[model samples]
Target: MGKTLVIDLEDVILEGDILDVGEKNFGIIYNISKEAEDELSLDYVSSDTKIELKERKYDACTFFFDLNKIWTSIEKEKLIKEISSYLKEFGEIFIWDINKERGKVFNNKIKVILPNEKIKEFTFRNLNVLLSSNIEEIKKILEKYFEIEETKAWEDVFFIKGKKIGTKVNEEEKIKYEGTDYSN
Candidate 1:
């Protein structure tokens, strides 16, 4: 199968030129954003990524965030559940935050306050994922769905990589990730 990569439009790609690498290596590129459909066209006109403006499916997806965007425990759980539904099985999901350590603590606090049903439905058990935060409670939630492959902290960001327990199984489900593009 050809490699596919999905990126959030508001991500650091425009600033860091990360799209250059994905364009070179992946066969399909999907840009997801809350912006009007063509809003990002100008930004990518000169890039080699051959941006697929009409497609939404992808084998991998990336999200960059600040903990402040998630104000409540329920919001956090909803965000996770929404994103998980959009992912392909064995798909790689990357969540990055500059203050990831603080995010770890925030995640744990929210987990304690949220309901078990909310947590269970949104669990990330079907994909290969990397999270910038590393609170033990957050790790426990991820471990329920993925096999912990690695854990490390670098340049002030804590990260964990986990591979899904089985191969792709839920790709047939139709679920669109909601919320403002930059925020989700």
Candidate 2:
């Protein structure tokens, strides 16, 4: 059964479902323009690539400038799965990552101002592009847990928004994969 997870929910969330909105987290806590990246960099993830859930329900989540930083396709897929568990039924999710093709063009045009007060040409390569994928790949993974509603692009960045569908099929898959032990 190579088919992916399904978002079916019986005791799940719908548009009018009563969802408890927890203490909202504004994921973007830093303003890069107000600080130097070299002085205060915190984008690094630890050895565990797991996206742990908070002890509260959320109606919406966002991956503002961090999606591509996940270094592996498997890890990114895992992240999508983890996020799927964090939201209520019919919750919304938003993602923004730099487009691979357009990011190249955008990166090449970046000019850094030197300490000597002169601008020098530099190609930072999307500041560190790790998993730069197209819209198709994104839709494929998102469709596992959501019915993708919209997608848009702005220069080098792409955005996708979708609503959580259900969890019945996914729940069954989990149970199936976690079969009871039989030392056969």
Which predicted model would earn the best TM-score? 2
* lDDT per residue as tens, model 2, 1-184: 1112111112211222122211221322122211333343222122342232344455565664455555666777887877777677788876655556323322434232333243343232345533465666777888988889988765555668898887768778888879677787
State the TM-score for model 2: 0.52
Per-residue C-alpha lDDT of model 1 across residues 66-177, encoded as one tens digit per residue: 3224444455555444444434455444443333433242222111111111121111111112333434534565554455665654443344445444423443232333
Best by lDDT: 2
Misplaced by over 4 Å in model 1 are: 1-56, 98-134, 144-147, 164-184
Clashes in each model (backbone N, CA, C under 3 Å)?
0, 6
* TM-score for each of the candidates: 0.36, 0.52
- Against the reference, the lDDT scores of all candidates come to 0.34, 0.52
lDDT of 2: 0.52
In model 2, the Cα lDDT at residue 42 comes to 25
